[model samples]
Target: MNFFKKLFGKKTGSSNGANQGRANFSGVYSTEHFNERYNEFSLEKDMLDGCLKMIEGYFIDNQIERIIEGPVNHPANLDQVDQSGFGFVLYCQAFELSEGEATMFLAFAFSDYLITKYGFKLYKDQKPDHPLRGMTLKYDKDGVVLSLYPFEYTVKVLKGNETFSALEEKLKANLKELPKVDELLKNFGIGGDK
Candidate 1:
């Protein structure tokens, strides 16, 4: 619809630069290679939306509050991270998921939501000389970019031996403040073009 038109209207950033990795070109961020990757991502739009809906339904079914109460077009900020929020952790623990399962699922759902709704695109750095070698990167045309796993440090909150109340206390009292998503990218030498 109109959204797709606006999103794909003009590709910018370091997309067409030769120094960028050549393979797996998604038209949103790169152009040297074929845009098959972009095509795949475009085609998966429905699946991503469906997954969001499924998560919403699961929460409703369990009588927990909806993580996303409205349209998914919110700003992509760390303070607004829904998947790994307190309610989400409770849901995961309620289902008796292991720490690995909870973290992976939270990360995937968070990534999917960001891509489908927030205009972010995925890029993997495969070049040997790149500092972000082998990292899955995410960015928007507005120059917000970062490692895909921004919650890497936050996941340590999920110690397998802790009780839910104890985990909550640790998360609230012990964990230091998380950096903003763009700040996190800066730490990895990624963004700051603003």
Candidate 2:
């Protein structure tokens, strides 16, 4: 308890319900609001701690010996991607997943958030968007697996995608150079610097 207070600072009650609470995360979408969108409920504090711990293990397993947290970026949500939990985006050292390789960038949005707000449709039952549901991470999942494949269509109709593309190019080019975002990602144990 004392450790969490030191790390995440104080936890505050959320107005939504008596059982729910909001944890501070001003710089990123780590608030309980967004965190709840991904983790299973166990006590707001414990869920967060678990993420932190999991992140740490990932770092060691991946051999990111020195570097800690990575940067947090909120790229505009893609129409093709689920937006509900599109809240947390962490940029880290590149890692590979069973699904595929992610180039040091990941984003998360809540499957449950979509279901509760939009209706609890299975990831497959959704509509034209059904096929795209795989891009959105489900509750209790770890990092998001990023691939531009999900945005191929959305990138066309959406405005500013060109700018986003340019920014992305620059971001990819500078992934290791960005200090604070990298540091925060390190603290979160999301990934290590390359």
Candidate 3:
């Protein structure tokens, strides 16, 4: 409880590239970074829950080993995103279906496999404790857009022209480096944040 008090005591700050998002100093920001401020609570509960369930099912069926949840708190950005580094920092409850038949959701932040400043070294335990890169995925009638929240360290390195092909290539590279989802299913078996 004391640890929670200390952590919730102060306000954390972050920035967007072209504009600045707002944050309240109150511990109400205790959820994921973009969750509370982004009005994630307004999403239709049943549909959002269904989508989340479907996404997880899709991962299980397709053998993709990616984090399927949002950040537990506000997170910073990572400089060198290696193979295992995960960055979609979003709120799980953040989702919507537009009148135009589009969808949007805040993504989760942080990764379990974050290395120290030296990317050469590896973390001993695969724990999702580190606060790293974060962004939101908006699904419109046209397509999906990954809006990365700009941080001093991450935006410059991660945002390279921000084209469709570039985004595809980066995602491909990241997925290729991850462990096989089937293998993780056999081993980790949803053993709390693999």
Candidate 4:
């Protein structure tokens, strides 16, 4: 019934084979497993889009700036809180949303933006004991893989110690470094050496 419940519910996928065309994978994980992972992503795409629309509605209703830039540091926005909903105190105060709702809203909205703007893919890592065992964003560029936890970044910013603009800027800087690494490999004849 709650918004967070809808956005963060169990992963679901169709039985029809939906992973037949994927080719961007760069990890050691089997292609079969990667394809399996994609099934869930495919199913969640529409739901995530709907969630974004809901956030957009909230933005318009509240007259809050739709752009993702601002300080998240209010006195009550401490990182220390219940695991179920943490670091959303500032958002709750500013937007008049509950901790759980704010957490889900910010996580989905920002993560979706990063994925769309930067070509990252939604990934659900099912490996036990892995660092990225839950929802993650992954970018694979010519065998170079970058795994990101945008939700974790969101949580940190919402703790009132950082700003969303700073996070976006940091990501932009880091993305610039990836191409340099690729150029270095090209100069070394990584592809031609063989």
Selected candidate, larger lDDT, 2 vs 3: 2
Which lDDT tens digits does candidate 3 get at residues 1-60?
000111111244544432122211121112244333333122345754554453444334
Question: What's the lDDT for all of these models?
Answer: 0.38, 0.29, 0.26, 0.47
Which residue pairs overlap in candidate 3's backbone? 88-108, 89-107, 89-108, 89-109, 90-107, 90-108
Model number with the top lDDT: 4
* lDDT tens per residue, model 1, 90-167: 655677866555554444455554566444455444441234222232443333222333234225324432222232
Model 3 ranges off by over 4 Å: 1-41, 67-194
Candidates arranged by TM-score, highest first:
4, 1, 3, 2
Question: Where is model 2 more than 4 Å wrong at Cα?
Answer: 1-26, 29-34, 39-153, 156-168, 180-194
Better of 2 and 4 by lDDT: 4
Q: Which regions of candidate 1 deviate over 4 angstroms? A: 1-54, 71-97, 124-135, 140-194
Please give the lDDT score for candidate 1. 0.38
Per residue, candidate 2 scores C-alpha lDDT tens digits across 9-120 of 2455666654222223323444453434333222244543443343344445444432213211223322212122211122122322321112112212122223333232
The total of clashing pairs for model 4 equals 2
| Local error of candidate 4 at residue 153 (angstroms) | 1.7
Name the top TM-score candidate. Answer: 4
Which residue window of length 10 is worst by lDDT in model 4?
1-10
Task: Please state the error at residue 20 of candidate 3 in Å.
Answer: 12
Backbone clash numbers for all candidates listed: 0, 15, 6, 2
lDDT of 3 at 69: 37
